[model samples]
Target: MTTMARDPKGYYAVLGLDPEADAEAIRAAYRQRVKVVHPDRDPSTRAREEFRRLMEAYAVLKDVIRRAEYDGVAPAEAGGESDFTPMPVACGTCGSLTAQPRYVVFRTVRSYLIWAKLGRLDGIFCRDCADHAAARASIVSWLWGWWSLPGLILTPFALLANLFGGSKPRRENTRILLRQARAFLGRGDLVLARSLAEQAATFARGPDDRARVAALLRATDGAVSGHHRRLKSRWRPGGRVFLAQALPLLALPVTIAIFVLIAIRPWDQPVSTVAPIAVHPATVGEIRHVAVDGLKLRMAPLPGAPVLTLLDRFTTVEVNAATASPDWVGVRTPAGIEGYVETRALYAGSGSRFKTEWCSDNRGAPPTAGEILSRRVSGDHRLLVHNDGRRDGVVKLKTLAGSTVLSVYVPATFHIGVGGIPDGTYRIEYATGTRYSRGCALFIDEMQASVLPMTVTFHYQSPTATRSLTNIAEVWLSPQSGTVPRPLPLPPDRFAADD
Candidate 1:
């Protein structure tokens, strides 16, 4: 290797070339120097000396053998080789001499509301390289750095800097360029970082260097581009962001209006009119049935006592046995109204009017009555009848309260009755058997007195026995007035006496 002497008048210095310049570089330098100091352009004596020196430098450097021999003798002749040695503080990429303790200012935009000075990078970069590094850093800062209101407001200035910033110097070594690119990346200048990384790959010296540079380029490209894509997606207008910002503002008025309306509306207005229910004071056992509507319940057991409430038909009451009177009964209405009502207005037990009938085994035959062995009136207008041992009997009872019909199955010589009857006339109907039978009779028993007791008898005849005993198959009864008695729709086997 031909090395130049570290002196002012050395041939390399005369041609403005480095000691490591190749033959081609020496020729090019000669040509450029001849243009600057050629006699045709400059007639000065100093120009002629400079021109001669440039020719001499090129002549020795252009020939390989001559340059080698000259280099060997020139360093010693110029006073030993140590003075000519290059400093370690040179740009690894451009190979340009640099001073130590150089500083670079790094600025980053942290967010839309923040701009941060990230301090300085300390290294040995030449002026041109330093400018390039700063430009690349700024580009990355603007591209990927956190954005703030201030940074966003000053985005135009940063863009201008990126577009017309210092140009990057040409580099020969991939490693140096990669180092700077990484520095720019650290500063958040992804665009400039990527550009430098790609340039580094192109300048790579070997396959290994090239592969490393290529990998770096790919990584930078993927990461930076992916990050940029994410940022763009996040800041995209409309959709969820718009709805999130808009819904609360729109709903505020609606919510307020709803509350105001609720607050102002009349809440005390009556929704319904309810007549007060009058409760009556009475004993637990004195249960009285309501026989008619408009039956006034008084506050005391007297006609002149103030009326507390009225009673409806079939409404039950608990009579105050201790307050019983001849003409009035102290009753507690279903509403718990403690008062008095006329004795005729309420009946004992259930106030249900029933239609009853007696039937025989022979269908469609007019029913006849046989002798009643024993008959008595029980509580609540109930009739208990013991029949002579002659036939199977059935008593069908239908209530006026509703379509509630009951069939009593009476075997031969059995006892049965009808109960829960209101104070009303009832027409009794019956069916005859195959033997001599008597016609049906109607009987009315009024339960005016509380302790009224009664018995009943009916006559019948048979040709063979001429006896009063006979089998009674069925019986029927209905109110004598107001509503006519309808035909009993009895089931064919409903009245069959269970053996």
Candidate 2:
């Protein structure tokens, strides 16, 4: 293989896994897939494609010798493309070329804000390889969990159609709303849900249909949002006129309030105390110092080696070992930035060696739940965020308190939030490529709480009510706790298979 082919980026991306995927993670993912789409069981065309990707992922990852050899280079270049096509091997006896399909199937997640529903998503399945069975299974699971009683789902759609000058579709749309209302009632969002079921009751096309929906709502959430006597009396007198002018104004504020809430950041505790010395120095050298800030690590022996934390300008590091590259040295820096910097960049009066990984349990890749206190834009479109670094890493963006900073999403280059992000609701302003452009969309629940940094994938299509468009803050909150940490290409056991 060529030197460039060894990089694992493409291979990991293909598996929808992260470059740092561990061993056990790979096995479990493979096992889950094999049980459903194994060639031995499934025969659907989609199943075949899944079998190919699964086999190929294992084939590249399982070979220890191949993995080590491949790891030396970047894995990002590998793909299920034509260049890496798989050839069918013949059976020893028949010599028949058993056909193997190429490519794999996966789905994309999307999320957006509407009137008052929170953390809403509309998942759009990738029309690639996986079978319907797997897709449907996921939908059923979300129906009970991520979705906020069906009202969030149903109301958003109906209200949207009505808002956009399409009343005819309202009847059909109401059915979608009722089904979700029924679900919300099942889970207990009595107020908002009762209103949804009640609206659905009014929109039923026929008497039987209306009666059935009304009965279901009454039983599940205990009566509609409007009492029968009140509704009847309003129509007899002047209910239509009253609701016409008054309802919209009342609803307008509620709608705006919800949007404002999603934009606000929740609260969290703070990290109290000074930076603890996590490293010790060995040699005695007079290393000069540069600048210091809230940042933990500063100097490095080389480009990719361990970095020692520069507590102040007087700290020194004793060089215990050396490395092939200039980025890192044995004396070490915080988090391992050993390749590019020189020993002079660090204080060498003799304090302590730099800690190997300066990450705190709630820090470094971990996420908490705090409100987004503030946001700022860097000269070249960078996000400078100051979040509550102490407790619950969630920074609710709307409240504009405790944690705060600016963010800029430039289209050409990558724009990332600076520092740490606390999880909760947020009202983020996505950048329009132009200086005069207005912010396009708002996001909420936009982050999942975790201790690991995760990659997020989003699409422009109808994303299944998900967090795609919204929370780009802390990525990847799994279905449940103990779910394997993401970007994990392999299970935590053997690390990743060869490639």
Q: Give each model a TM-score.
A: 0.17, 0.16
Prediction 2 global C-alpha lDDT: 0.36
lDDT of 1 by residue, 46-127 (tens): 9999888888777767754335334434344454544232212244235553321122233434443455333222223455
The lDDT for every candidate, in the order shown, is 0.47, 0.36
Misplaced by over 4 Å in model 1 are 1-221, 225-227, 231-296, 299-457, 460-465, 468-499
Model 2 regions more than 4 Å off: 1-164, 167-171, 206-208, 220-499
The window of 10 residues in a row where model 2 has the poorest summed lDDT is 490-499
The prediction achieving the highest TM-score against the true structure is: 1
Residue 200 C-alpha lDDT in model 2 = 60
